[model samples]
Target: MNHRHLGRSGLMVSEIAYGNWLTHGSQVEKEAALACVRAALEEGITTFDTADVYAATRAEEVLGEALAGERRAGLEICTKVYWPTGPGPNDRGLSRKHVFESIHGSLRRLRTDYVDLYQAHRYDYATPLEETMLAFADLVRQGKALYVGVSEWRAEQIEAAAPLARELKIPFVSNQPQYSMLWRVIEDQVIPASERAGLGQIVWSPIAQGVLTGKYRTGQPLPVGSRAAHEDGARFIAKFLTDDLLGRVQQLQPIAQEAGLTMAQLAIAWVLQNRSVSAAIVGATRPEQVRENVKAAGVKLDDGLMRRIDEVLGEAVVRDPARTASPEKRP
Candidate 1:
């Protein structure tokens, strides 16, 4: 897989990062999850992304076991905080106590001494920004995390934090957002703000939660065991399930055929076309799905093909910057 420098940092991550979000602990069996990680490694993927709250933190344990024998130096392991890992009030947000305590739990679960990057899963409205950055700063000083980033934060939120990160002298490198052919919320505001702040994007849901894969068709039942068929997965993907959107997604099949790419590959390559994107995160339930996504790593779609995609998916894209948001109150 091709690699890119995350933001202006010297650390390089595989362009196609293997992520275990909904699949590792909740959707797929442990053996299946491990097999997918092996497939990723076999395809030369060196970066893996997970979070402390995913599947109540079981995802990290699964990933830890999967990467147990590998040379840690060769892998870029990233995880996040800012979500409730327990029922206690202290269990959530980016308060000093939570951030400090969360990293230890993450480290223990991931089986790593220090993560290459530790990110805020979402902006913490409840905690003071200073307390949050200071906590991350301390982790860096203590050698528990090498770099820090935020996910799904607004442009103004990033702008607000940039100077604080600079003041603290921590390596603030990336913002993980959901960006796909169908989800373009980050393009107008977040990308420009991140560019100014020296933050690259590690985008998730590049295939629009599997909508852009062209598997969910108009006037058809949801695939037997597809993401849309699962209760929790269905909620995140519901917005892209309209007949109008599904019909537009279907029209891209010929474009994929012409480019000798699968619908999923086409979706991934389309996202990487944006220079601000450092990496695209892909999650899989099966090993072959991991293999299929890595093929898009170095593939580039020419201008003509890109235009065709825009034309076909016209008006179906969600570009309103207001959609890039975090909860007003911590959950």
Candidate 2:
């Protein structure tokens, strides 16, 4: 495993990190999630990422249960805030009041004293940036969090954060964004801004939520018990899983084959190929998935392979959220 400093924080993070997103409190059983966590650690992946909104917050509880006592000391646990938890008006966002309250719940759920990196899950237009930055600084001062970050924020948002952190003297170490072979939106804005702000990038869904993994091929019915099978929030995935795009993705399979790598490995390797990225976060429902995804760390994408992938994707298929409809209704 390779390591990189998390921006200016100077904390060395593995090039591949484990994230509990759709799988932790939804698809994978507790024993399986625990085993996957162990597998990541054994492979030298020290950072664990989770969000407060994942599976309605049960993901944190499961991770906490799995990493209780001295076992918890072996890893760096990271979690995020934002997204509504309930009916209360104050239930979410990056307000100082909420940031202070949310971390307490997160700490209680994670069964840990402090998070290695506590991120604002998204940009909170409602809260003042100063309030959020100051709240994060307080968390560090109180020893509730070691460092602070943001996720899925636009480039300008990262730029906006730097001055606030500098004014408050708080360390803004990283930003987690979605970047993959199929999705290069970060290259447009987020990547450059993070670089300017000295915020190390950690990309989530580096496989584009398994689309680039060659799992959802053209003309195939959605796989049973797969994320494509997720009826609740995967309708957007179905929209872009078009025959034309799958054909394009399949055309690039030879590139991975010629390079002696799996499509998943190739996709992840491409994301980490950027020196600006501190890590690429992988979501695994099974322990075996962790084993498979981690191999991407050192696969290395050469210029010829990159050009071939671009030849297949062309300009890359960009999506408009407005074009997608609601997810499949639960039975």
| Index of the highest-TM-score prediction | 1
Instruction: Let me know the TM-score candidate 1 reaches against the reference structure.
Output: 0.99
How many residue-pair clashes does candidate 1 contain?
0
Best by lDDT: 1
TM-scores of the candidates are 0.99, 0.93
Model 1 RMSD, rounded to 1 decimal:
0.9
Cα lDDT of model 1 by residue, 142-224, tens digit:
99999999999999999999999999999999999999999999999999999999999999999999998999998889999
Candidate 1's displacement at residue 177, Å, is 0.3
> What's the number of clashes in each of the models?
0, 0
- Tens-digit per-residue lDDT, 26-101, candidate 2: 8889889999887887787878889878889899998888767646555778999988776787888888878888
